[model samples]
Target: MILKLISRSKQLVPHSPVRILSLYAVLALLLFSAVLLVGLMPADAHAARILEPKQISGAFPTLAASFNPHEQVGHDQMENMDHGHDSGLSVSTALFYTARIVYYTALLMAAGMMLWFSGIRSGSDEQRKRMQQWSLPMMRALLLASLLYVFANARSLMEGYGGGGPEWLRLFTETNTGQAWLALLILSLLGFAVIKASDTFKLIWALLLLAIESWSGHVAALQSNMNLGIVLDFIHLACAAVWSGGLMILLGLWFVDRKEAGRFAERFTTAAWISMALLIITGAAITLLLLPSLSYLFYTSWGIWLIVKIALVALVIVTGALLRARVRRGELPDGLMLKVDAGLMLVITLIVGVFTYMSPLPDNTPVRFHKMGETRHFTVNITPNEPGTNQFEVKIWLPEQLGEPSEVKLVLHSRDRQQLAPLEVPLAIFEDKSYESFPGFVRTSYHAEQMDIPFPGKWTAELQVVDKSGEKVEESIDFENY
Candidate 1:
């Protein structure tokens, strides 16, 4: 079956079998990972533990049927569903996954552009003009898109709430009324039309949009640390797009028009150098912010994936440098360079596919909790730490006159406010009670015991504190780690 699939891939792709196989390999990995994550999910507290697969299948048949026994779909589901909630995987994972997929797609588009550019021109002035005539509209469309982005971003900046959400709209806009939104839409169309007329204006408009994006990010940062995450996310996106998108354009011109290969190669080489530098710098900065320690890099799934991405990027640079040297020495034939460039770009895309499967470091952090009990009810707070490592502290408070110690039970399970459950994770803690000489009550705190969780996802920690007489209090906290 695999061989047949490979054979079909070779027939479908215009490039080499190796290239087609590489793409399929990446797709397989992504599908496998996603299935693994979903299939292995743990059940909520209300669920009964049945040895029968039928019990499991009856509830999640759509998910179960997607995997074979060896896929460990059930195992991962049990592990994730039974374990505690993850704080890291929520937002950071979302950002990393989204960014990597988009960047990879952009890289593939670059490869396509290269092939198109190289295959199109036959050194005739008439043919070159004709190609340009056809391509001009595409350029105009891209410019128009950029302009639209600019206007939309500008409105977001001016209104403070931006198109991203209602919160951003409320933050920037003096009035969150329908008329303002309508006006912004009209302005965006006007901006797009204006920018598409010329390259110079398009460039200007793109820059303006960039400025607006930056400003909006800055404003977002002030509201919460999540804003900083938002800023970094945008920067990562812009950098990825510039490098990948620009490369796609350059490759297109070189491969499609053999006559213009030399000039296009030279121009692309220069741009590639700049893009490589930016990619490296921003990538490093992102790493520092998320993977602050070697513990994170070596221990966490997100860290491991990031390491893989860095290695791939290095491979890309080396390949690009080699190609640049070949072009300089006139050793690479025009047609061959096109194929080689496309192949290498494909490698980048594949690496990005893996990256998308991994969680982002900034978003995946361990959670800590502090508990306060009132006469009427008990309250619990779950505080998330910096991304990468899983370590959280728990604190408990009891009234002095209760005379009996409360049996505090903490359960780390996988579930959310959406559909939650309790898991049988028997966490044991040994602590001694000492009087602090406070006026009335004693405060009991538990030092954080580090849980070495490798992957990024959602987890919930439930606390069940009972007195010696069996009077009990219950609370739960949710966390996500990427």
Candidate 2:
């Protein structure tokens, strides 16, 4: 269907500068609004605790901490979580995304140069000379970007770990991300040494580099049918590189000679369309695998970002179709349109970098566990046992002689006794109607409430209930916070 639409839109019509400007203006407005909406929306406070540092050390504490370096390490680990965007502003994360953009841009440029070299036979002498002129510098940039990516990634990992030494080394040597980085370093060295290699070899190596990148992302963490996920991810990364990289090369050549660039642009448009089709298909499949339901697409932060990416990609496709139409008409392609398309692609790449670090699952639902009360005959089901905010659901079942409880209260006690007072959880009745009786005892009521655990450790929950007869029953359940 996409191909048919592209084919139908291929006929050249008069290029109107006003229309082009208007199109871009609309796109800019849409993008700005989407960003503003995301910014204005409220972020989950509990979700932020999972990623951001909760506090900053005071000057006096820092000075005193210098005497005990190990204590500082522990403090840093406790402070630095998974570094989610909702948590806070993270300089390390910003740098990491910057590094990713540079690295991927360099990779695409290298791949574009290879694509250009493969078809060097079809172009004029001047065009061939232009390709040779840009080739070495692009390869050198790729090597530099690859090295910078490694350094930035290592620094980010160190920040997450609180410090780096043997731990960093272990991560690099033992983890899948580390293995992928090691492979990329080797490829970078090879690329540097063979700057003037055959086009096929360079292209093959570039694809390999991108494939390793796929292994470093969320796809690699899949436990069910892992091979299928990795294969789809590799194809997605490869197609993206080819489409974007080819454009980078075309943009450069278009400046040298628009007439000469038209021929290559025509060929690239066909390839780009094919790449775009595959991207949409693979992207949809991956999204379905990761997302729990359609509701998450709007309700979760991850889904909002995915929507932004889809919008940017739609802009790219529209721009590509217009460029192809201009090329087919034997007219100079719209330079402004091409630039807009390339800029959007770069922004999309940065979004991809952000997504790589984020969790796809919604924060509202987490790991759940149930606790049974021995004397009170009630069960408390805790949704998400993590050391942060949680929801507790209580279900009470009474014996044939005992009536349903009239009141229930939840209390939290710190095992270490460091807290000044036990925290109380105010639970409201969720379902109070009596259950149908077929057995000796009948199920009664259920209550639920939200609570926060400030720290990770052992804690005890005390449930106190007042029966219909005014008899009070107390039961305690112990659990550990992650």
Candidate 3:
């Protein structure tokens, strides 16, 4: 068991300062080597056409909006598929993210306490008794969090469906998220039976929970290099859970029993160091596998959040160094740094929740934009904004006030410093029943199965409509020609 690893790690020969430096030097070398490999290694060039956008404009802000903007294809849809801006967070989206953060905290804290207090022989009687007193409540919290996660995920999947219980059940039981939630619920329920079980069983139980989380993660289902992705993510989540979760419990110990906490801090912090090392390595690898290109690091919402997470993680690392120094100096030097570490960790957890919620690939995610007006709305969607075969969808909406349009058409023109004639594309009236999300607007849709984008460059799409009175309205959008 990994708990046995914790005990064994403690008995290893102590490293002198020179030896510690050497170890760090070796780790740094490996880290750079890994980063280099990721950089040189080709991304999945033949990615899905209907890509997940590397969550380009999809993150916490975008999660509030639906992924399938084509359902109603109106104002809400336009807002969601907007290229760069964030849509307001919806209530359901908020609930999903909140449930996720709660479950993350609960899982980390509960599992860390169980493993440290029961699995490790070094843990004192007081620690074991304390863990016991907290076990029931912690298990209940995990169960509750798991249930919340299940409901929130189901609600997200069922958005705009307006289906009854049967549909909801189908979505849960038939989808990947549903299966993951099922496993999580079962594991959470199993935790109750093992609350007072043997320490080895507790370790196995904790690992099973981590495995569920990893299996449910986006990495696990990666179509390219799937096995490697799943294994890396499982190990990644395990290490992160051990370090962050144990740190949370350690913080609690500091408050309730500082003397015991002081005795435990050095060993726990030392273990955290190793866990953190693996965490960084795998996290970097996962990032490389998921991100479409290096440019995405600056251009996308997911990338931005990742930068924020990494920055905060650096602060946590600094706090860890401070803690290690304090432990070695025979004084905590006040718990100010500890509080700082906990606060940073909590924020990082929330951001991590965003990462878990969004898609990692550039497949279905699109470069979508729209022009809205008092009378009409024009929208365009280009899939996987890359030079190659792509899918294009154009939607035009006219309010009832405008009456029946005599003529409505869309035109395309290349914008690369060259004189080119405009090409007109036919549009057809589209009707959809799901009007609850975006109502009052009648929409017409045009779809192209495969548009061979000749090159990666700028192009302009123009929309022109003629009202009953023969008055013409025009609008154009310039895009990277996705």
Candidate 4:
């Protein structure tokens, strides 16, 4: 019905200059609106709450007290010790993920045009003109998407780093993500400059742009085999772009002229098979590198999201198979089925964006242990025993006093086999003595003041309890960081 309308409209106004100009103006206005929407989006909620040096120093009293009389650990050190323990699904995170989805979809559309235009021989003059007309709007959308993508990256950085001043500039100049964004911007410009050159050149440029995506993802920092992982990531992204993007272009063709698109559908089907195979291989390689065990698939949020993506991909495959069967039987593929497949692919792409910010497995698990000493029994509980900042708590039970001890102190030693100064955390006695501190009305025990673990790796926690006689009893326990 839409194609019939298009045909009728073209016949009615075949050479109406006013109508063509008005259509182009409307498209330009829409593109401008999209750019404005991204630019005017609100900043993240937490961006305003970034603590200054004084604020950080005041937050952790124990850490500030440890400063030497002549020298103090500066703001940088304190800031490093502070971790963003807030939930991952923030408004800013959601916006960035949405931006990513938009960017990837635009990329596929642009690249898919190249793939489609390159695979088939030139059709009649009318078909060629139609393809060119479609390409112009697609290219414009791609450029707009690239701009939005860069804006999203910058916005995320600004929110994460607190302000859009020197800190944000430093990140842009120093980080891999910044470098990749810069590279993408350059590529986008290059693509625009040579868009009217040749189909081969456009195809090469699109693939290169897609490959650059690897640099900004987890593949760039893979610990086991960084180089191979990045290469595989590039392959995965390229194949995905071709498969998803190609389908989008084919759908556009179906809308424009179903018969012409069907002529090349068989060839695209063959390429799609190869693309799917490569996607599975490369995606599996990257997934194995990330997930420690199969248990994570059901246990971790990242793993569950990954499973959803896998199921969506499977659905796409099934839909593609059904479409191929229809095509083979000389029947036009159902547009609704194709739409469902495209929608699934879109969701899968968005999930990939979300995965970029989420961890593949759980990182924080509290460590608990008990130690029997000569004069004191210590029950230690370390909350969120992760590699970053952590809270350390100890409850000392004095068998003789039948009341709270006068003093409690904690010293941390890095068990890295290198000689280092001990980090002392003075524990203040909780005056309120809540039920958690004295669960049984036996006032012999009091909760020690909590302290933060500023760093990770193997560490030993030495607890010292001073009795009324000024005698100190010490107990040490060793543990590894997450």
Could you give the C-alpha RMSD of every candidate to the true structure, in order shown?
Answer: 19.6, 15.9, 9.7, 15.0
lDDT of each residue in 206-245, candidate 3, tens digit only: 8788877877676654545444556677777777777776
Candidate 2 lDDT by residue in tens digits, 1-482: 00111125553232244644464456446434533443343332212222222331221122222322234233354565453333466776667778887887787667656654543333246765777777778878888888899888766555545335776676566655666787888887787655566555756776777778776666555433334456667767777877887777678877878876676686677668767877876676566545434455776667888999999899889998999898778777788987888898888877876666666755433433344444346667666765556777776666667756778888888895555499887687665554534355546655554476654445788888887778887878887543
Candidate 4 C-alpha error for residue 35, in Å: 41
- Writing each residue's lDDT as its tens digit, candidate 4 over 1-482 gives 00001244443113244654465456446434533442343321111111233444565343312311111212243443333334667886677778877887777777766655555444335444665777777777777788888887666434434534765555555555666777887877776665676656766777778777876666554433445556667777777877786677567768877875675566556567767866776777666555443455776678888888888889989988988888888877678877887888888878876676676646656779786555556777777675434566677766554456667777788886448789886655455355643333233433433455644456888878777777778888888652
Q: How accurate is candidate 4 locally (lDDT)?
A: 0.62
Candidate closest to the true structure, highest TM-score: 3
Q: How far does residue 7 in candidate 4 sit from its true spot (Å)?
A: 37
lDDT for position 314 in model 1: 75
Assess every candidate by TM-score.
0.41, 0.62, 0.66, 0.64
Q: Where is the poorest 10-residue window by lDDT in model 3? A: 59-68
Measured with C-alpha atoms, the lDDT of residue 369 in candidate 1 is: 45
Instruction: Kindly report which residue stretches of model 3 are placed more than 4 angstroms away from their true locations once superposed.
Output: 5-40, 45-87, 117-123, 360-449, 452-478
**Residue-level lDDT for 458 in candidate 3:** 61
**Which wins on lDDT, candidate 3 or candidate 4?**
3
In lDDT terms, how accurate is model 3? Answer: 0.66
Candidate 2: residue 208 lDDT (0-100) = 79
Residue pairs clashing, model 3: 50-363, 50-364, 51-363, 51-364, 51-365, 52-363, 52-364, 53-362, 54-361
Quantify all predictions' global Cα lDDT against the true fold: 0.44, 0.64, 0.66, 0.62
